[model samples]
Target chain A: SQTIHQWPATLVQPVGSPLSLECTVEGTSNPNLYWYRQAAGRGLQLLFYSIGIDQISSEVPQNLSASRPQDRQFILSSKKLLLSDSGFYLCAWRNGGILGDIQYFGAGTRLSVL
Target chain B: AQTVTQSQPEMSVQEAETVTLSCTYDTSESDYYLFWYKQPPSRQMILVIRQEAYKQQNATENRFSVNFQKAAKSFSLKISDSQLGDAAMYFCAYRSTFGNEKLTFGTGTRLTIIP
Candidate 1:
């Protein structure tokens, strides 16, 4: 069985503060990782995705960035947070190769930027 | 790029009754995948059902099923014997079968089950 862990479950950060969110997957190797954000009443938006270590693709231009340090470890970071950066962050992992469409999501982090 | 559309912003169904949620998508590819995800107040997204474009027979999981019309680009979810536990925000998503791993999601429809 594959499991994804994300933390801290909830975060409260002041403006211009640094942000770091970590996601790690156990029981799977070389899995594709993704970062998504959901606003209060809006749909989720894809922020970043990585095919392999050190290879990341960003969907939108924002203050947030993502990195894949290991095969199953992904991190989302920001040098300076903005008020608009507040939202629910989700980490997902998918099987690699052909036919890896279904994604398994982790418990999201509730980030409140005051 | 694939795009999913769930027009209904919100829907309500009485317990033990049936309800259908509408979903439409646009894509140039012949084969792809469609899915329904449920997000409760707890904010965890869970997969309810999935449909592959190549399969003509609709996929069913227990009380949940899909009416997939490939030509019409419509994939609707039918929940039989709906319960209060079924109340959640349902999201429709599309994924390319050709190789794209990214899933394009719809705005979602908030389903409220009345007691």
Candidate 2:
């Protein structure tokens, strides 16, 4: 069975600080990875997605960025965080072979920017 | 561009009762996919159910089922015998079949199961 793991389950970072959130998947290779954000009482917003290594597509223009360093390792980073950047971040993966494939999500990382 | 709409921001239902959460989407593409995701208090996005645009029959999973109307562009989720564990935020999402894997999500409906 495939599983997704995200680290720093919860974080409290000061404003303008650098941020890094990692996501890794097991039991699958060449999977489609995605990064999403959910503000309080808001819907899941797609921030970035990668079909392959070094192929990140950003949906929203913001301070956050994403990278796929390995086949199953994805990272979300920000040089300087903003107060609006505080939210629950989710990592998702889908089978690359299936078009419009269903996505499986990780436990998510809750970031509180002060 | 595809858009998903979930009108109800909050909903409450007594335990063991049935409730239907409505979701509608607008898409120019004839072939696409619709999905319902559950975000619990922990804020984990879990896939609850999914419906393919080409399929005519509704999709069901245990107590959860989707009323899919492709022509109407309506996809409603019906939770039968709702349980306390069902309390969460439900979101409707859409993905185009033509190489767009990014899901466009709705505002979500917070379902509260009353004891």
Candidate 3:
């Protein structure tokens, strides 16, 4: 069985501070990783997705960025955080195989920017 | 471009009763996938059901099913004998099989189960 892990479960960062959220998957290789953000009462918005180690796609233009350092390790980072950047961050992973289309999500990280 | 629409922002139903949540999508591609995801108070997304465009018959899980109308471009989820655990934010998503794997998600419908 494959599982995804994301941390820290809760984060409080000051404005203009750096941000780093990590997500990793076990029991699968070369999986598709994605980053999504959900505001207080708003729906989730896709921020970034990566098909491979060097292939990353951005769905929205924002202060956040994503990277795939390893086959199953993905990281979301920001040089300087904004007040608008505060939200619930979710990390998802889907199988890269031909018959895999279902996406599995992690516990998520709650970031409160002050 | 593909888009998913969940018109209802919130819905409530009494426990043990049935309730239906509607979802509509727009896509030019013929082969694709539609899914219903449940985000409970815990905030973890759980897959409820899935439907493939090629299948004519509707898809059903234990207590959850989807009414898939390809021609109508509609996919609605029906929950039978709703329980308190059914209360959550339901999201509809779409993904094309033509090499584009990014999922386009709807805003979501918050379902509240009354005791």
- TM-scores, in order shown? 0.97, 0.97, 0.96
* Per-model DockQ: 0.65, 0.84, 0.63
Q: Where does the lowest 10-residue lDDT sum fall in candidate 3 chain B?
A: B95-104
What tens digits encode model 2's per-residue C-alpha lDDT throughout A42-84?
Answer: 8888999999999999999999999998999999999999999
User: What TM-score does chain A reach in every model?
Assistant: 0.97, 0.98, 0.96
**Window of ten residues with lowest summed lDDT in model 2 chain A:** A95-104
Q: lDDT tens digits, residues B16-105, model 3?
A: 999999999999988899999999998988999999899999999999999999999999999999999999999999988887767788
Residue B18 of model 2, lDDT score: 97
Q: Residues B70-93, candidate 1: write the lDDT tens digits.
A: 999999999999999999999999
The interface root mean square deviation of candidate 3 comes to: 1.6
Q: Write the per-residue lDDT of candidate 2 for residues B1-115, one digit (tens) a residue.
A: 7889999999999999999999999988888889999988988888999999999989999999999998899999999999999999999999888876789999999999999
- List ranges where model 2 is wrong by over 4 Å: none
**How accurate locally is residue B74 in candidate 2, as Cα lDDT from 0 to 100?**
97
| Interface root mean square deviation per prediction | 1.2, 0.9, 1.6
* Cα lDDT listed for each candidate: 0.93, 0.94, 0.93
Q: Which has the greatest TM-score?
A: 2
Alpha carbon lDDT at B102, candidate 3: 76
